[model samples]
Target chain A: MKISIKRQYFIEQLNHCLKAISPRTTLPILNGIKIDVSDDQMILTGSDSEISIEITIPAEIDNEEILEIEEPGSVVLTGRFFVDIIKKLSGDFVDLETTENFQTKITAGKSEFNLSGNDSNQYPLLPEVNDADSLVLSSAVLKTIINQTNFAVSLSETRPVLTGVNWNFNKDNISFTATDSHRLALRRLLDKTFNTEISNAIIPGKSLSELSKILTDSDEDVEINLSQNQVLFTYGNMRFISRLLEGNYPDTSRLFPENYETKVSVNNSEFYHAIDRVSLLAREGGNNVIRMTVENNNVELTSNSPEVGTVNEAVNASAIEGEDIKISFNSKYMMEALRAIQDEEVTIEFFGTMRPFTITPSESSEVVQLILPIRTY
Target chain B: MKISIKRQYFIEQLNHCLKAISPRTTLPILNGIKIDVSDDQMILTGSDSEISIEITIPAEIDNEEILEIEEPGSVVLTGRFFVDIIKKLSGDFVDLETTENFQTKITAGKSEFNLSGNDSNQYPLLPEVNDADSLVLSSAVLKTIINQTNFAVSLSETRPVLTGVNWNFNKDNISFTATDSHRLALRRLLDKTFNTEISNAIIPGKSLSELSKILTDSDEDVEINLSQNQVLFTYGNMRFISRLLEGNYPDTSRLFPENYETKVSVNNSEFYHAIDRVSLLAREGGNNVIRMTVENNNVELTSNSPEVGTVNEAVNASAIEGEDIKISFNSKYMMEALRAIQDEEVTIEFFGTMRPFTITPSESSEVVQLILPIRTY
Candidate 1:
């Protein structure tokens, strides 16, 4: 491949492409990024068996020439070194040329690099997905959905299905849920609709987390195509494909309690800070458990480590209803849930001292976080 | 201690004091910070056997009351936990009271902490240093001296003396030098004299690094007292004591080359960036060595990893003198020396292809960095 491209533009595309190249890939070819040059555009592809990212840079963009292709060819270059070289080259434009022997020469300003390249044909082919069954959602909305629930996914591999976020689409409403048995996070979007039949998919939380990072924050729609075992996301000039976990996700709809014995509404920041301080002592105590007691208009949080110290903090709640209750739970889980609320005020509903409790944003009911109390007799 | 102090003001003092507490101290008491409160002021002290820091927060400063002493007492609290609690407390003022049996109560806003404290009498006393023989230097100057030479110190404990920065005050000049036997960094200040006899001391680079962080950037003089085995630095309302490295530091004055076969002047940034990029290949090669060849006004830098690739960069020098020469050296050492120069234009003097070279600012002679060339076939 022979091409001349803007350094800044090339660096941006390379960053997105490198995300798919995993550091511990067993296949040596997966450690390299494949670049294909043609008369109309250049396509860069990076993959690590499970996820692949391909981006296209057109010959001209926004009435400005972005690339000039002298010859059409292909080569695979080591991803890490290629990215670092392009970033540090001191020039406005970079020229890349591949020889018949698969040797690539990269030149920018007065700096020149010659790297041994692998045959592009050796790279794995991207999985093809039929577009007949597809769903569309804005990149911004998709990113928010992933961020709100991905953290609650199980980090252990004992139950592989729980390590993924379960997505269910019905009629015009879509819901995303993730659970680790101890806690659960669910987010629902009411306005999104699918043109195809109802669909359900379990996407690895790690994959969704990586996808969220590469997706733009713009309102442009991202077209997603689903197959029997893989999913494809197409946005702008980039295509991201990830494999779906092969298993049935446990039903979590029954995890949310239908009734509450106590409810407390408190300012998010005030309550968050109080728990954060108490967690310091809790963390030292090995279990990271803190007790929360509500009475009238006051909520008291307490944690202690015999060797370190004990902390007691009281934050005023906006309102309290139902019976007063005392509950003990892992402070870390509560803190993570509170951070994901993204609201000024949050309402927490408790069923008793041992049952799971749910926290919801005071302004919206689309997001819910549920936590199981720890027994600390 | 029984005292009501502003949280911000108290946190600042606590941070400075905690710097001396080491996490892996054999003596448990050394891991705690001692708080001694008197009618006039409250002193916070932390020690790790190698270094000790004592900071005093006066009851009043600049005609403004910063602390109110309700009762006079002393207690030693766990350093890490104490700092964390104070930082997270949401209050303008914090009240600390020592109860019977050494239990301490800390109250701020609606947050209260009860910590088991040790008897202050168990803490080691600060070493008494005679002020009869002392040297004074501005904190800014000391900080600059540490920054310029500390990076060159040996990180390995094979040679204990080389792990410290050697300070020699003689006549009307003071010189600080550090070397790991591969490269040497020396900084000299002229026209600065001391009131006592000339002295030589080797201060551990790690201790100097911590001292530099706690020292103010102002030009206020920092009184340094030299004892047989320890050094004391007093500034404002703080006293810092550090144990001196007991060994003879190798004299580095003879290491600087007296003559040169080649001299090159180049823009500091240009040279630095080129070396940084070329080093990527050198690092992958396992030796991290790069070669530089200079003739006339052109300089070429090249590095290669047989399995990875090769990079060659050419930069134009402002001027080149004497015979043409080619030298290979560790790129990391060269990059660090160039960064320490802090000058727009730098002059590099080379003795031969294998001898050591010196880098210094084009306009000043106060600082010099000498690097030993690596032999590359």
Candidate 2:
């Protein structure tokens, strides 16, 4: 197999695929990137067992010659070293040729590197998904949905299902939910079209992270097809696939409270800063608990560690309703929830001292974050 | 103690002093910064036994108000927490007040933080150095000298002296040398005004690394005073004192030979890239040794792992003389020394197959790097 491609354009696509390749794969060939060249396009594939990314470069882009295929073939090369060499190679065009003995030669300008290649047949094949069960959503919405909820997923392997974010789709809406038992994050987007109704799946948090980076923020829509064991997201010429966790996700809809005795609205930045300062002192303590006292027009946040000292800060609030109450919760969870709010002002609701509370944007009911209160004296 | 200072300016000085403060200190007072407010200036000090830094903020700079001293007093505050709070404070001017009970109030904008302060008498005093044995050099030259030789120091604690760089000053020139015993780097500068003949002293590589970041590449001169146990550098209203490592430094002047059997000249960038590529394969093999063979005008660089096959590439040399020879050395050491040369083209002088060779810029003899050859079959 022999091919010559533009260095810059080829390097860009290789970088995206490299994100899916893991350095600690037990199978030696799984640590490589598989390359397939055909008469019309060139395909690059990188995967670990959990996630796989494949990108194709077409024959023509803006009437420029990108790839010239002398022969159609496939080969797998070391992903880490090959990417470094290509990025640092000083030339406009790079030439790749593979011999029948599985020896590959790479040349650009005056520099040439030869590396041993593995048989492409050794690489795992991607599972096929039916197009009829595909769903369509804008890239911007997809990235936001992942970033907002993925961080709340549990990282421990003991509870494997909790390590993945639960995705549920209806006729025209998509909902994402994640929880570590201590805190929960949920986001919903309406107007997304889905071919199937009321389907639920648990996708690993790690795969969503890699997918978030590859998705563009443009208005272009991305196509997603789901199967019983795998999910595939196709954007332009790139195909991203991930293995789904085999378990039923816990019901998170009941975790958020339906009503609250007290609610307070405050500037998002001011409230975030107040919690940030209190966290410095609480972080030194064992439980990372910070207390909030709400009054008529002022909210006071305080935390103390007997060994270190205490911090007391108060910020003006937009409005306070019902009975004034004091609530204590994890400072880190509140900070993360406040940071995810897109609006300038946020409204926080409290049911009781021990029950889970809810925080949402002032005008939007689309995103809600819940944190279980920590009992403190 | 009572004072009001511009928040940004105070934070900058605090940031500089933070370099000397280590997170974990056996003596509790050493982890705190000493703040002294006098009638004329405000001083901040941070020390960790091996190194100490003191920065003074005068009452006025260019007829501008920088510090307002309301009362004269001194106190020590925890370095780690103080620096963080000052950096995140939201105010243009910060008000600092110390109570009789030793609790200090730091007020900025609408936020207030109260931290417990310690007695200033508990902090260690800075060492004294005589002005009679002082030398002056521009910050740029001092910084350059440190950068070129610091990378060659040994990181192992087995040989304490080898972990520091040796500085030698004679009647007309000053020189710096560092080596981990495998390779050595030496840089010399001729300054006739620096006539004091001082003995060699080894300064810790870690101290020099911190000083390099504080010193700017400007024409401003910094004063260096050498005493029996310590070295002091004063510049821009700041004094930096570092304890010198005690031991006799190894004599490396005898490492370089007066003559050579072969000499070759090559472009700096081109040679660097060739060695970089060859090292990729060599690193996988045990010692990262790359062999070079010179036959008249053609020079070939090769490396073989036996299991991973072999790579041979020819690089163009502008000049080659004497007999044909093949030698092997660690590619990493060769590349580092080549990068330190301050010329477009460098000349390498080889004494024999087992002896160490020297690489120097063709245009000047101010800097030289020597690497010992490895035994390869």
> What shift in Å separates residue A164 of candidate 1 from its native position after superposition?
0.5
Runs in model 1 deviating more than 4 A are: A195-198, A295-298
Error of 2 at A207 (Å): 0.5
lDDT of model 1 at position B262 = 91
Per-residue lDDT of model 1, residues B1-377, tens digit only: 68899899888889999899999999999889999998788989999999999998898899888999989999999998889999999878999999987999999988999999999999998888777867888999888888899999999999999999998887878888999999999998888766555378899999999999987789999999987788899988899999999988887777887878899999999999999999988987787899999866678999988888888999778888988988999999999999888789999999998899999999999889999999977
Where is model 1 chain B poorest over a 10-residue stretch in terms of lDDT? Answer: B191-200
lDDT (C-alpha) at residue B345 in model 2: 97
- Residues B290-321, candidate 2: write the lDDT tens digits: 99998866888888776454556678788998
Q: Write the per-residue lDDT of candidate 2 for residues A64-138, one digit (tens) a residue.
A: 999888878889988987887788676788999998677888887666677788899989998777667667878
How much DockQ does model 1 earn?
0.82
- Over the full model, what C-alpha lDDT does candidate 1 score relative to the true structure? 0.90
- Top of the candidates by lDDT: 1
